[model samples]
Target: MGETSLRRLPLVIMLLAAGCARQAPSPAPPRVETAAAQLPEQSSAIVVPVTADLRMLERGLDANTPRVLWTVDEHRDTCVRGKRVDLGIGKVKLTPDLGCRIVGQVTRGAIRVAGAGERIDITMPVSAKIAVRDIGGVLGETATARAIVHATGRLGVTGDWQPRATLDIAYDWREPPGIDIAGQRITFTSRADEKLKRVVRRLERDLPKEVAKLDLRRQLGDVWQRAFTVIELSKRNPPAWMRVTPRALGFGGYRIEGRQLRLTLAAEALTQTFVGRRPADPTPTPLPPPSRVAGQPGLRFFIPVLADYAQLEPVVLRTLRKLAAGGITLTGIGPVDVDFGKVTVYATTGNRLAVGVTARVVPRDRDFPATSGEAWLTAQPYNDEGSQLVQARDVKLAADTDSTAVDLIVSLLDATQVQRAVALALRHDFAPDYRKVLGKAQHAIGARQEGDFFLSTDVTRVTTGQLQVTGAGLFLPVRAEGSARIDYRPR
Candidate 1:
């Protein structure tokens, strides 16, 4: 009987060894699968159009110009040979001619300036009064004439941003100076027209001198320096900034409206966005020569909205836990419960995101062993253009364990429910941040003055780019588009 028992024990030992060999392998230890380092930051352009107001030039002309332009005094021979001159009182007979003296002055009125096409039209009013004496040696009378001096100023800017103009000056008498007496008229239009030529020459020479004093270079330099600084998009919450480093100046040309001359200077700059604290301003470079600008000029800048991975972890954990509340049914394994542990998210190469989840599977069947391991998943984050809602797409579950049971479980976890859970977990609504940033930008981008130069901007449109992940967090580049203008207001 002892020998038979020994034989049975040997068979039992063999069976036990077989059972040990059949047991599932131990689950791989939870690994911290780190994503690739964040990619290098890219930069965008900020092209702001600078509108220069030239109303001051008109005022300078008014201040520097003289009230009275020139005076006219002339005496000529009046002929009535073999003719009878009929005066209002009686007829006067002249043997040969009479000496006549005409003396008057052309007085200037208010200076008027208006924009016509690409040129500025300047109008100067003048009045001429002449006294005609010894008309036939019998009668003398006084006559008056009014005229307007017309000047067309072709405005231009030098390479150094100096205001320059070439004027074509001319004048016409509104009412010709003439004396009508004794049914005869004595006119002085030819003589007055000839005298006005001198006034035209004087104006053509002096007006440009005034325009040169506009000192647009100084004002433009101030604008260029101010543009080199940083602009705050948000003060707190997410603290974002845009550093503008001017690259070049572009001359789009000029236009005139009313008395204002607008010079379109496109300030081309390389703008980079920062998410955390304020970035240092870019060092100012010397204002470069004007470059030729193609396309329209406007303000373009990106406002980065970041969501820290640390902040997103808890949200993802909570979502995963909620989704896993009811036992997750594994195919051929019945209801398999899971206790969600920690969640780690980071950026990966190819603009993708890597998510690692530490989870312990609780088995319902005693025969099945409890398994604990991490499941590393990858996905692409994106958003629609101009939308603030960020969502995950192209989700893929990766196996990071050696145990066949755990791999099967992870395979089942890649089911629709788990994938949906992860997708929902990645759902981040940036609507509030978008509205706040836009509001703050619109308010902050308004009129900003430095000394006598007033810079104003009007935001016309807002756009958004693709979602980008970095070591810091998820960043959505929201761009603000608008037109900017700079005015020179001498205080």
Candidate 2:
């Protein structure tokens, strides 16, 4: 055979073996690689076709569904997805703005992602049914509960045996009035995992706003210094509030384990005393005439605060040191007493104002150990900026860890701290948001300024014997959302 004829024969044989035509399988559609772009201006739109390997997609959704009685085309199918769906088959084009309308027998297998464009209206036979279809990231106003959703922003899990992923947002079943819905609905996006990555970027952009929130969180850590506080210190205290458990996973947020947080102070910690008038020598003064009893002497002087109220003992104490310096020899000491005559509340307009007092004092008896014959007073209020610090006078005192001459400076200091904390928590916790720190995020790219996309600002967690707060020392855990511009290029 001629050389040209020989080469032709070989080419024909190879094409037959390689199966490039006729019974040959068509090449798999090129993988879709969407380019980043501005969301939409006027009818900004883009198109994506239906995928062939869809049953796998359906299984992914089934795994996310809370419950299901789903059904796909019945062909003696050993469908482990087990849900049953007696529906027709077909494909619908997707767009960007105007959501594409779906019409046809819903397959647990069908996956639809409509960006923005004019809707694709599908027309199915009269017996039409669309099972559960979940369009994640496209929130519908009012309904996805806030159940302390424990989330691991970077990747972690803790729940029931079924690996509950950060992507279990499968579509709960629903249908339009005239349309039909199978027993249950479970449809997931093809790139549900990718959504998690987007959240990381979002968090990075939102870190700043959390500054106020973080301050409050830290203060709570300081105040509640309960089992979560300087754990090592708690160990030193012995018999402390023993609370240890797996902290629920959460990113860009602080979880208050449960409500009705209770706080209390110890009575044994207070021990101090004040002084009043009495005789120095234990010898009973020559009995004053009974007339004297009925006179000024008859006037029973009770200084309960000067000493133990229960033990009306007249003991010499040092609350009044200048009296000693004044050379006024007191042949007697006290039952130096005090009482709060009234309790009134002051606040501004709306009256949602909150004011509280946390005081630790020295008990009367042991309070003034040295020059223990003086009166102790207290009234410290921490107010907002440009606001007056409310002060209360003559608050009865007894020596305790957080008490002092100038209003139990330690306790006042603590109260001052707590006041700041409470204010921040109430003010910022309710109204502040850090997501905006990522201002003007390319809304054009369909990204939102939400906690979902929050990122941390260089922080690390050093476990405190298993149960530990996210950040330690002076830093707060912030959530920065969206992208940032770093000028340096990596080596």
Candidate 3:
């Protein structure tokens, strides 16, 4: 009987060993999974156009005309040819007399601008009056005379002023002459009379010298200099950004609309994001080819933002610590200490964002101890109207732990609540920073003055596109759209 009992004990011992081996827990499932987020190859671009109206040119010309152009001293020399009759004899003689003086004033007429083969053709009508004293030879030295002349003309301005700052300006006259001497009209056939021709020649030579005194080249140079000046776009902490390039400049021709001339100055504004203190003036580059689009001008550009996970990890950890500090109690467990291991952000099947979270949970109660688990959360990102930020919405748990204790803890934790809290915190903390940077950028893209043209930009809308994973961090493509208004009012 003792031998049989020993045999039974061996079998019982074998059964007990088998049961213990079966009951022992398998190695705890991996705490967390690492993931890599993918990004797109190409990003969008920003386009900005600058346009100028010709009517502004007309206004500038009208406003800046000088009232008194030329003045002659009271005692100036006068030369004139006269026919003297002695005993019914007619003879022509040239006489020079003293105490002669003249004064001329500019009476401007309609001004027009035309586009002609890379040059702007400006036509201005000249209506001027000259007061001449001592016009009736030495015998009639006290006789006074007045003459009014009218003609159409153009400014002899030649050079590549649009691309380069070089400008050569002179005066050139055009069309048939209309002259009135003492209210007596003179008609010229085939050729002007000797007196009229002499007066016209004097006008052709003298007017340009007076016009040159205006020094339009220098005025225009100052305008172009301002145009080429660097315009700031964003004002950040250490470095600022700016728009540095003017790609194209040309006339889109002109048209007469009602009482005004509508001229178009087409230009393309190119921008590069620069981050630093404002630098010295850049050398002027050759103007780009003319822009194809006509009429109203606007600008477009693309801004790429790197949302690195490494930088974001601290934010997440801080949020989790705050939640832990507030004391989160699971249904079956007392208050627990929650510590996150590694967090990974990646793109899922549908280009959505998936955040993989690894966590260690230790119950306050001495009986329950500690456990490891993972949570894969799926979320859709969108631009929030309330906060104006790239925010996560529709947060859901994709995968989590299978351990009974951990599973119960996760269930009570409510992935939706956790994800919502994270999304709110991220948006609240990060959105204002993005807005501050963008506001500085918008202010930096200020108004510019070029010649008679005043160009200003208004950023109408700002929006964000999809989020992608990159080696540097999470990449977000932002777009800004705005209109550029160019007014011609010389200052």
List candidate 1 stretches off by more than 4 Å.
1-57, 70-104, 132-140, 181-195, 236-238, 277-280, 294-296, 324-327, 331-333, 336-388, 393-399, 404-416, 442-446, 458-463, 479-481
Per-residue lDDT over 360-471 for candidate 1, one digit per residue giving the tens place of the 0 to 100 score: 7765754445556566777778888878899998887654434422343464457677877888888888887777778877787778887677788877887777777766
TM-score of 1: 0.74
Q: Which candidate gets the maximum lDDT versus the true structure? A: 1
**Candidate lDDT values, in order:** 0.70, 0.21, 0.48
Residue 111: error of model 1 in Å? 2.1
**Candidate 3 structure quality by residue, lDDT tens digits, 1-491:** 57855555643454334334433222222222222222222211222322334455545554554433333334444333233445546554543333334444434455554443334445455443444545443322122222334333434333433321122223333433333433433322222234344444544454445434334355444544455555555443324344445545554544444434334455555554443456566577654444454434555554444454556666666776677677667654557777766665545544446565667677676445465555566666555433335566777666544432234224423544467666664442345545765676677665756665566777777776655444444445456667666554546
For model 2, residues 35-120, the per-residue Cα lDDT tens digits are 11111111101111111122222333334422222223222111112233444564333422222123223222222211112111
Worst 10 residues of 1 by lDDT: 35-44
Error of 2 at 293 (Å): 51
Which portions of model 3 miss their true places by more than 4 Å? 1-141, 151-250, 253-263, 268-292, 304-315, 331-360, 364-367, 372-378, 384-387, 397-416, 428-431, 447-478, 482-491
Error of 3 at 89 (Å): 24
Model 2 TM-score is 0.15
lDDT of 1 at 352: 69
TM-score rank, highest first?
1, 3, 2
